[model samples]
Target: MADPTSLLPQPNREEDPETPSNNLHHSLDQIIEQSEASFGWNQFLQSILVSLASLFDGTQTFISVYTDATPTWHCTSGTTTCNSSSDICDLSTSDWAWDSISSKTIISDWNLQCSSSFITGLPASSYFMGGVIGGLLLGTLADSSLGRKRLLVISCITMSVAAFATIFSTNVWIYSALRFVSGIGRSCISTCVLVLLMERVGRKWRPRVGIMQFFFFTLGFLSLPAIAYINRANSWRALYLCTSIPAMLYCFLLQFFVKESPRWLFMNGRGEEAIAILKKSALSNPNSEFNSVLLSADLLSQVPESTKSIDPYKSMKDLFAKKWAMKRTLIVMVLGFGIGMVYYGMPLGVGNLGFNIYLSVMFNALLEIPSYPLTLIILEKWSRKLSVLWFCLVSGICGVVCAVVGDKQKVIRIVLELASFFCSRTAWNLISMFTVELFPTCVRNSATSLLRQSYILSAVFSSMLVSVGSSNGFLSYGVFGVAIFVSGFFVAFLPDTRGGTLCDTMDEQERKESMILG
Candidate 1:
């Protein structure tokens, strides 16, 4: 095969060494491509370590499904006024009792069974609201200041600490407040971990490694049913303690093992650290002669002017300053909002499925397993636009069917709901990778986190929908179906980024776009 570096974008070193020419501008993608950074065993190991954060993020986000669930109730003996069909809100408190201890769920402990939907959904809404703020507030920091690895570790710790504190919550108000804090912390983990992992590897391994993050997230989601089942009789506090302690310890692993994204380092004018990471990656690859190439090329000197004026807030500005970037960001944000409604809302609304909640959640989580690998396969053949559009359309149809079927066909209803969630998961997974490819590295973290905020912003409403859906299927599934179906069409406007090299700076990406347009 031809030498890999021979095909990469090369800087014009023949120009005056003192005054670098515009020809000297190069993206980190070009540098890594030119360096022939191999996807070696160490790189694979680092990818796993970084992606593991998603596992905990997934667990923390969904654990509330069990901890906040309204426990089943039964009529007490000799209760002439109450029967199985009687609404608990209409019955006397003494006439019916919870199936499990009050401590098993916050709903029972806080006496929220008869409360309004807004009150019952507050904690979850609080969590997603916190995520929206966190993503907008912390998103630019990763791209401009903290870099990816530090922000990832800090986010993990913030979430764990907030979770640990949740065990002490005395009322629904306290619990909701802490959940909001946890949501803020949890917001940055997936975005930072993903950008960090994608930047660490070469283009050949990017898609495969990117998909690995979601696999870990599925594992986290799957773990919930088993953990909740095991702690069925214990206090809801145990759930918080169980997930938080290990996550806190995981931060240490992240701190010691994970390396910052070299692309972020170079883009922000930290040339030495950027070179060190690149050289380390080169050494890891047995086939690489990248170190010698690095020495000869002096790519760092070609760093763009955008990096020299690195302001943490400027990263956020870049997203809206360009008409193309703003339009692309808004379209994807809308797509994420719809997918988020279904992706998150379904699991939270599983109690309304008329099937056993644990079994329903298990099926939903299990369905996510196939979607990632299927996404991998689909992206290999389909454009990101088509893959997301079609999968979301299928999910929307199934969700509408689930709403229409209702309680009459319990089996079919559950099956269709699971299918909807599966397709939504596929679309959700694809759009994330889609967003990553949509923006340059200069604003990639901000863009990814912004997309997540759109998801979280939708999720804020999803919690209330789930509360209402517990009594009305149309409120939850029907709304989710319509939202996603309408939003899926927006994908047609987004430029397909599959198989394209990642751009390191705004100028580099803008130049590429102009060339294609001109």
Candidate 2:
């Protein structure tokens, strides 16, 4: 493998006693020219599109399985087949039985579906736990080692392979293990897809790009129900196999087309390669006036002098040192945690509320589409703090109303559900954008990844809460409402990043502070 550091930009230098000091200036001129010839709008869009492919991979892997029947409540026929004509055996619905059946069915629809003789709900919960672990581990990997493009490609390949492997599991244990692996890949892909988009796109375009990311994600989400509805008659294994097809295609497309982020390259100190990439990018743009020397000079000027001596680890430590950093981190962390609880909790809670599970999830996901536009409008016209605060408050209040209305009042339930969906979706969109802005670029990925992990970690707790709340009426929704309401208070602490330039280094922050004080 190429040296990772080689991807970053380096300053120009000359080595010889005869060389004048001006020789360094001449070299800087050439570097700037090269950098200018490299950047273009097409390169930016293409890189983002490729990175976003992982989002589709995640959606496919996540929603393939659905609840059908319970193990203890099985129909007595000694025969396990649910769809005899399709030769698909009905797997046990007991927590263990469900996983084993889903796993085996995904592997291949055989005549006899395996039963979970010893498996239980604990194993079922393990699948989710595995997802949490996967999101954190892979998310960190994406930030630390694998550049976004490589990480995304790898995630799709592994997720596809794991999804396919799920079809062949012999028992619940194997099935659960495979799902866990798939979850890890899915989490990594999802997190990186967002991180990569935000990092690569221009500051002015981040919100719109984020909207596009989720828009495509919603496209995947919409496709899932249709796939499920169409394949409902087939064995469950067929669903896993079918969804894996897109990921395989994405893997092929990414290998040949995707480019790494220039910003990431610069940060890593691969000035030469970063310049090379910019040259390629500029050439790709028909409208661009390509000037390699000018680009090189510009880049050289921007390159920090002491970067060679700087420690990446120390950069991270500085993120929490000041009141502003500490305050932003705490607020975003709480926002993620609360959003995770509500975002995941709502769908599960709605299902338990005796509504049409499919319609509820679909409608909730559909609501997210409008949020992108709403976000764009709010971000442009309203302050970031105000936009986030308004959305959180609305969503929280609606969630509380949803809880109080109950299932008996159909009209009231429908209205509250729709309102809750809109609020929650908007809140999450703002939170994602806000988190990206809170930290400086050097440690942005690390900080965002850690905060996001807090969200995923909170999800595990939400899952447990859902399980407990399922036994009592209105408890899950009520608890979810309370959590979201509390999250709104933290939104007040978040800074307004609207109209702010991307903070590439702490010096930028210092400069801004100085200007404000002056």
Candidate 3:
């Protein structure tokens, strides 16, 4: 009988030093490239299922803005009792008459507007805070025991439950906590889905499929305004019910239909399972002849020696273990955080831009329509680094234009802000795919989540900035412009990953200490 170890493919040092056994990413890529599954229907179905999480996320994002809307009010008699313009200390039912007594939010219903803006903003902020905490807790699970499919399933369920229970939120405290939990679950869903989708397909097609997946997210974003517009005057609960129900259905759909990532299965020493998946993918295509060699179990287990023994938590620790890796992470996060300000904050501030909140959100969402197809094309035609750089440059310039224009120029302000958001959305799409291409699969979740945490962290401040600048464009748009512009230079410092293969470990991605530097 042949020895099991002897059958393992030995790595040739000279020809391909970076390619290793547990680098199941490339192994899966090789398998797909050699088989008909590279662009097969099975993979297409899988991509569609996986990208649903983004749609869930996009809906959750702007729902709060419309749901938590402040009710319009009027002074009953041109009156004597009201003391100040925005009463910071006192707001009573007697002091104002809601324009529509039937339509209201917790803030208006409870008369919490007189409370500090900090208090009014707490629920939204809690959502971002929970996302930060959740990233620390569940982000690494994608790389280890749970894997991407399980983590995404559990996370989506959590989000759906939280969102559904929000229907019962009787007061501010209960509502805030639920939003926090939803944020926690939504962040987990966002992190895992991208990693799962990217791992499921071949490296060559990764850009095309992954960038285009956000189209579903755009659809989700567009849907919210219509949902809200119809019910904005009736009940905010309607918005929650709509988003939560679809997300609930989504969890079941993913759990039953989706398969565990083949790369993840291979990485965990489930060789037979991974090979079986590859064979299934191969046989799923009707146009091509079957190839048995593509499903070789011997090839699936050829990862680096370190990956076999590396602790999953160590993947998180490794981000800062080396000076270069830490530097790479910080730079990426800074870029993400800088642009993340706009990516995460734009929807929140859309109402501030003097447009109807519903139309503004839908208009902002409209930009994503063009951004998606252009991004898909740009990703294929350009360097990942240059794509980010150009996106930043355009977004930053438009943002500054938004700041320079006057309030009297409402059309100009609207156009400039839209253009800025368009570029920011483009940058956002590139950056999302860039993280996958930039890091190894082992720490891919940790790396992307860390950068995302930075985005959330920046969002914490972006929320504050939005509050401080809601009435003033310069404070928000100018800051976003400057940060994005400088981050573009930081983006240039990172490696260009266009047409590069995915690696399993940082050592493989960098290959040398100097590959990334301070």
Candidate 4:
């Protein structure tokens, strides 16, 4: 067993004395880390319960792929100007019609096949735009006031309500508006959930648990194809209804099964509550020999007065207040933007793959399964910086090749597209886990949310590109390749965080930095 006193800071006799609050926080960090070393059934249950949110997020996000797709059309029996090769926009409305009922998809229901790219892309763009708004406005609450569990429940419920209400939309405008609202709610689910899961586990288990969260996301994404295919003959509203109901029920499950992150509690000055939860977790694990004496009320009382108060908006302000945090934030966001462009864009743009949309999307979604384990290995065995850089490079190369090969070489184009998407997804998983490790818990969610927002912001443009690329391939695939490739180089500026201790405060982070420099 490690010496408890040695885990804490010593008295400073130098010019700059280390504050009592800092030492207390350092002791708490060490205590928490030690207690979390053994993963038990209790932690496993908690990890799974928290990860399910990603399932719904993935479901609602890609449901748009099928719900908004323009169904295949054919000419009416005797139409003079309409034929198999005819552009639907060039023919009279009466001369040609969609194979599926018009109500099956938004494109056919709203007669958007002939609409401008901007109009066709508006709903998806609005949804991503709402994510931007939600991330900026609501994300900070997790770190500062509401705490991780409450914010997660709120975000999930909000998303579910918005998604359920979308079934009532009467026009494309209303539909887009509801999607925007859903985006706001969804913007924080993955971020909060990811942070909460990481904080709950030990450093040894953190990467694996984080990857498990993505596994649920993959499960949610995989369900979309089967759900959409089953509801292909039904109205698009059926898909929303199916996805929303389960998500609302999931909110209830979260309430009953989930616990607030202990790290967030400690940071927000609820040391007693944090200790209780940690004790409970340690008790649940048979291998853990946690010392009950280490978590006394006296330890809680020693927490600095400055750390005891909750400032609801201070988290975001703190990000900009520090120069290192600011520079780190900008670099990661730029990297996130490029990965986001390809991450969300490829699934939505599966329509342009010159194959059946269902099969095309399934192929892409199926590829994501292997990427998670592969990413886990890469993170475990290699440097985060190198994994990110190479994944981006390979994804970009495949994307550009897909564009250059064109649709005529159908098999080659599809294979390259899948390869590109696969690599991008791997990079996406890496950067997300990487971002969490980069920032201290003090502003972790805020930093992650900002990264997510950057991705969503880029997705807004990706929506437009996908719409335009339905007719022009270079805009989507070619641009996606170039963007990610250029962005990958930025990883060189970031420090490798493979085995660093997770910091709980900005002060702690600064101390670690100073140690490394001197």
Give lDDT per model, in order.
Answer: 0.84, 0.59, 0.75, 0.85
Candidate 3 residue 213 Cα shift, in angstroms, is 3.4
- Give one digit per residue, the lDDT tens place, for model 4 in 33-137: 667878878888999999999999999888889888888988885956778878888888888878988898888887888889888889899999999999999
TM-score of 3: 0.89
**Prediction 3 global C-alpha lDDT:** 0.75
Q: Which stretches of candidate 1 lie over 4 Å from their true place?
A: 1-27, 34-37, 304-309
Model 2: per-residue lDDT, tens digit, 1-518? 23222333442333222112233322332232333334466646674566457456535533622422221212334454542222224334331233233323332232223333123222234545665676555554443456566777877787778877877776556776776777666655655666666665555556766566666766776677677667656666677777877677778877777766556566556666656665665576454443534333444554534343454345445667766767777788788777766776666555456566567767776777787788788877787777766766776777677777755786676567677767776777777777777666666666676666666666666656665665563566666667777877787766566755455565555555555445
lDDT of 3 by residue, 1-518 (tens): 22233323443556544454443444455565444345778877888888888888888866777777676666554457664364524445566676775346777766676666677778888888888888888888788777889988988898888999998988889999999998898777666777787776666677777764678778888898898777767777778988899899988899999888777777676756766776777776664333544434446446323244557677788888877678888888888888888776667776667777777888988879998788878888888788888889888888888878887787888888888888888887888888887777778888888877877876777676677676677787778788788888898677776655677666666663233332
Clashes of each: 0, 37, 4, 0
| Candidate 1 TM-score, true structure as reference | 0.94
Inter-residue clash pairs, candidate 1? none
Model 3 misplaced stretches (Cα beyond 4 Å): 1-28, 36-38, 78-96, 286-290, 294-297, 300-310, 512-518
Which structure is stronger by TM-score: 2 or 3?
3
Cand. 2 Cα-lDDT = 0.59
